[model samples]
Target: MRVAIVGAGLMGAQIGCEYALGGHEVRLHARDLRRAQQRVDEGFALVDRHALFTADEVRAAAARVSTAADPGDAASGADLLVESLPEDLELKTAVLRAALAEAPEAHVATNTSSLSIAAIGEAIGSPERTVGTHYLNPPLLMPPVEVIGGERTAPETVELARKTLIALGKLPVVVRRDVPGFVWNRLQFALVRECAWLVEHGVASAEDVDVVMREGLARRWRRVGPLRAVALGGIDTWNRSGRGIVPDLSNARELPDLATVAITEGNVSDDAGARDAALARELREERALGAAR
Candidate 1:
């Protein structure tokens, strides 16, 4: 397969590397030459640093990956064109239009975290080709690559995406509807909002809350998952619990933009980074334990 990635950012480069390693030819293309090369360099550095793949494996994958100067150069002969530009709607719509235009026959997917896939399709004038492929951060280690199709997207497009992801050694969960936040973020933010509200109300210290997730919820969810865990006790009890717990969850209608606030308030970004890394590591460890069991 010939894969053309329409950005040279961390996400695009990581995805390109993974596809290349899966035995596909990949092109990391960007408008600016220097930025493209920088991402290429950082991607290679990651391959060298990672403990997962052996030296020769990395060498072979790196050999298959190349760089392109522009979207046209990348998309001309690509079988799969992926838009991994910034999350801004205008930027993504413009890039998707250009890249998909270059290769009308190629399958198109975007890595937008929040934008509407249908709106993007309308902008691109290729509603059937465009799909949402919300790959998790650190795509190599993180699992569950989301495959969501727009309203006008062809069924074949979804199937091809699923086949491609499975071939590349990924778990692709198809989101049947075109909803905002999709599935992953909805579930994630649902929990996060409650946690934030709890912290605000002095219900638990931040450290203590982490323990409940790490030592309590994480253990149970790893074994049976939330739905199955609930089902273990039958639907009647699960319904009773939901009736009690759902109303008590967070009901905040608006979210404060904490990017600048967190920076000004303290080094909350650094703390968040460390905490997230710990959580990701724990998740991987628990997944391994589940597999062993």
Candidate 2:
């Protein structure tokens, strides 16, 4: 398949690399040549880190990647057109409008993290051809790609998107309805809000809270979601646990003043680099295992 990725940023570049690695022709379109080149460099660096291929192998894969200055150039003859532009509604609308005009036959997908797919599709003027193909940051490493369908999204578009993701070695979870932030962000935000509340109330220190989650909840969550984890603990036990847990302040006034200040000061304990590297390593290992098979 010929895949065209608009916006040569981190996510867009990574997606292009993934498609290239999967043996597809990929075209990366950016507003500027320098930005496109930067993304290509970053994509190669990530591919090298994973050891999915040697430098020579990456170079070969990169041969399949081309850069374009405009939407029309990238979308031309593209089988799939993916937009990974900024999260802004108006900007995305403009890009999609141009893309659809250029590649009327290509399936369109958005890498929107939280925005409404319905709204984006409306802006593109062909809602049936547009669907949400949200990838987690660093698409080369992430295994799951949420395939969301807007109100006007066609069934064929969803199936084709899923099939294309499968070809790229990703697990595509189809979301039938368009929801804000999709599934992952909502889940993450729910936990974050509570964690912030806890810190605000002096319930636990930030490090300690992270320790508890990483060492305790995260491991369990990897195997089972929260609801299933509770179910496995026995309904009676869950009931007892639920009864003891008190609800925090749902109002703005309940927010801890120092919590906001701490976050602004970049005191958040998210080990973003370590997490990204670890995930990349895992993906490389998986690719190695697949190659062995």
lDDT of 1 by residue, 22-102 (tens): 899998788686776677666666555544457788888889988877688788888988888887878877776677778
How do the residues 1-293 of candidate 2 rate in per-residue lDDT, one tens digit apiece?
88899888888988888888889999888988787878887888877876767889788888899998888888888888899999999998887778767788888899999999989888878788889999987787789999999999999999999998898789998887798889988777677767777676788887777778888999888789889987898989988777777444333434355446243444333556678778887777778898899
Report the C-alpha displacement of residue 193, candidate 1, in angstroms: 1.0
Global lDDT of each model? 0.80, 0.83
Let me know the TM-score candidate 1 reaches against the reference structure.
0.86
Best by lDDT: 2
TM-score of 2: 0.89
Off by over 4 Å in 1: 257-293
C-alpha root-mean-square deviation, each candidate: 3.6, 2.9
